[model samples]
Target: MSDTNAIGLHQGSASDLAAKLNELLANYQIFYMNVRGYHWNVKGPNFFELHEKFEEFYTDLLVKVDEVAERILTLGHKPVHAYSDYTTLSRIQEDKDVHDGEACVRGVLSGFQTLIEFQREILSVASDADDEGTASQISDYIREQEKTVWMLGAYLG
Candidate 1:
């Protein structure tokens, strides 16, 4: 536990939140890597559009990855960044091979939706724990990922 708890934040076992945060961080890492892969491998008549979009998503993911890790650290937990941790903790599975352009968008949309749902659950747990900071962070993450999902879904259509 941290030496000082934020106001309205109860002194509860951070074990559960810590575990969830680690899982979220791991998922984010996998998602980011996959986005990067799409950015590099995307090819088709829509190449310019899809490739640029993938780059934008990857940039957002990079920022989000840092934000989540920092939030974990703020809670007095060590953020998981290693490949081993990501592989074990992440639920997001990587594509073995690049698919069609539309399929790539679908894949990313699936990932974003999965992440949004997981983060929403974590936020609920944080709220129940009376950890306002963590809850707020989860809300922010959910909002951002939800927007990403919408954009990706739109691209798929």
Candidate 2:
């Protein structure tokens, strides 16, 4: 039998893509919870603004988390679902009790930086594997987040 997966991609390449996507999912899960905490705990003069923005961020992250998990399934692999797995695999650690607006923004910026850099690596691997779907998805995320990073940096300045 041929070595291709159900989706017609080479099994080895699809497995590699799924592995990277799972890592991304873990990071997204951690980041999502962090933003949710930021939304709920933000205080001070900019509380309203930061709270609203954090809600937006976490909402988007939730969608991305689902999409990444589904993509892993499409690749014929299981996405890591347990909170234990997320905590173990994610590089973006939990940010607890960050009530300061600036601190929360900084935390978000750091998470975006981590995700963008990691996505770039995944993009390279996806490109090498000729996995255009994964590459395109990651490319869109990178493009959107580069702009966000710039805006967040401006906010901090």
> Scored by CA lDDT, what does every candidate get?
0.82, 0.95
Tens-digit lDDT track for model 2 on 91-120?
899999788889999999999999999999
Question: What is the RMSD, in Å, between candidate 2 and the native fold over all Cα?
Answer: 0.7
**Residue pairs with backbone overlap in model 1:** none
Candidate 2 at residue 74, lDDT? 90
By how many angstroms RMSD does model 1 differ from the true structure? 2.3
Candidates in order, TM-scores: namely 0.89, 0.98
Report the poorest 10 consecutive residues by lDDT, candidate 2: 1-10
Candidate 1 residue lDDT tens string, 36-139 = 88888877788888898888888988898898888777776789879888988999997647846887788789888989889888988998887888888889
How does residue 76 of candidate 1 score in lDDT? 66
Candidate 2 stretches greater than 4 Å from native:
none
In candidate 1, how many clashes are counted?
0
